[model samples]
Target: MADASGLELVEQALGHRFSDRTLLEQGLTHASAEAGYSYERLEFLGDRVLGLVVAGLLLARFPDEDEGEIGRRFSALVQADTLSEIGGQLGLADHVRAASGVVNDSILADVVEALIAAIFEDAGMDVAAEFVRRHWELRIDAVTAPPQDPKTALQEWSQARARGLPSYHDIGREGPDHAPRFTVEVHVDGAEPVQATGASKRAAERDAAAIMLSMLDPESHG
Candidate 1:
């Protein structure tokens, strides 16, 4: 509610200050423009800005890695889930000025991109790149890292072993609509189904598949 406190805290989290005070305010704005001017345009720019910065960082960090490896790692790092996780870690949800009914991790993730766009506009590419670097430094090297999606890995393994395609189902659903908890069952070829729950259906499916993957290949789990 207090702009001063909000500004101070966000600046601390972002490790930079806006020369244009309005840009910072715009970064916190949501598409619910009745609440304020939306940051949607900024988000678009930030998405590309973030991608370029990450790509440059990846190129420098993993010279030995082949193009396919780089592309895969880049995909992993820039996915919505990963960005949303980063947004939550920075407590961007608390700081964003969204409407009363805005309740989704994907929106929070978009806010992160919008915020990055705001930074790029307010400051410059250099500072924006630095901001990305500071937040994503740990993951830069990991761009060359192997895939972490257990479900896909498990599917490949099963297919190789003469098993048919894996299937997943939303077996159970619970909790409120805004934040429903989903239970998923992953069925590997001719194997007993493994179940898992998460905040979303996709996540639940991944978890269920992860458990099956672990059971099928203990080495992958570690």
Candidate 2:
């Protein structure tokens, strides 16, 4: 296969190689990077599968919690950042077969879901669910902290204690139209700035501000 190396890398990172090689191949294919049969389709399937699995898990784990709590936790677990972080952790970047010039992590998010979808298709939902449980359950279970919108949090912090409103700038953009990645810089009124990247301009800006806040509150950032 053309992407044999990529396939091997995937198996290495995943700790299990696919019995049906084509499934793994499909998982590694991003529409922007590949000609056809991309991970987009798998991502769609995985999105639904993820929702089902998470909902079931949340119900079992948080028996006393209400619907709103489960929904929030599910949203947090399936968020883009969480997926991207999992992709990075699994070293998906090293194995992902994308088109030239598509270096952004946007594809990373879809690829994670696509891989899950592939696993579900190849082995079955039971197999895929267990894999997800091993990798995601603990993180999903530990919901001790309140979620804050990083951009809003930063803005309010600046307004309350800092000199003025925080400023954000689109520093750079990369990749094609379908999946352009943005780099954003956030500057506080009178403080040093922070920069980060995301799939959308808003996401990048929020991440940059979040990074800045983490610097300000290291103890709470975790």
Candidate 3:
């Protein structure tokens, strides 16, 4: 409803009521908005909270899965893409207070974590875990098997073709120190070099390798 407040809609989407309204407000405030408070700190705490809950969910859901398999599933579930997708489904972007025209996967992902932290702070781990389960259950169920790590897959592909190992180089860095962006170039013998940007060098390398892998074998990547 257009008449409904942003916080109200967010609370509805999250299926939780906030005792301290300030937490919800802070969670929705972006760093660029110049709001005296922002979501960064909450996002940091929520990241760890999300990880622990997701790990517990995986262990309970797949008792037979070994640590490696569970770890892969956990990584996929907590990736920025996944979090942003979930945020979109919950209409979180509509409520985020950011500078005009500022929107990205990182922002959306950060706010989602911030909200989770707020919930955890308000109602403790049980409520926070339940909220995660409610929103993430379908995704967890839809995954038939743990997806292969893109970097590892790319390395195996290069080795199979006798290309030795792919090399990664940091080509550029930008943005603020707190939230820096890194651009990495990945080079493999006999193939055109590919580059990608991410919040960190490791993430950039993974992205570049994934792109290169997709280019080299579209069907496999798909």
TM-score for model 3? 0.87
Cα RMSD of predicted structure 1: 3.7
Q: Which 10 residues in a row give candidate 2 its minimum summed lDDT?
A: 97-106
Each prediction's Cα lDDT score?
0.78, 0.79, 0.87
- Candidate with the larger lDDT of 1 and 2: 2
Report the C-alpha lDDT of model 3 over 1-222, residue by residue, as the tens digit: 122477788899999988987888988888777878889999999999999999988999999999999999999999888899999999888888876645666788988999899999999999999989988888899998998878888899999879989999999999764457899999988889999998767779889999999899964455
Segments of candidate 2 deviating more than 4 angstroms: 151-175, 182-197, 208-222
lDDT of 1 by residue, 41-145 (tens): 888999999999988888888888888777777777777678888888887777777556554676677778888888898888999999899888797654446
**On residues 63-159, what C-alpha lDDT tens digit does candidate 2 reach at each position?**
8877776766777788777888888998887767776645456678888899889889988998889878877888865776435577777887778
Pairs of colliding residues, candidate 1: none
Global lDDT of model 1: 0.78
**How badly does each model clash, as a count of residue pairs?**
0, 2, 0
Q: List the residue pairs that clash in candidate 3.
A: none
Q: Write the number of the candidate with greater TM-score, choosing between 2 and 3.
A: 3
Q: Given candidate 1, what's the lDDT at residue 211?
A: 87
Write the candidate numbers in order of decreasing lDDT. 3, 2, 1
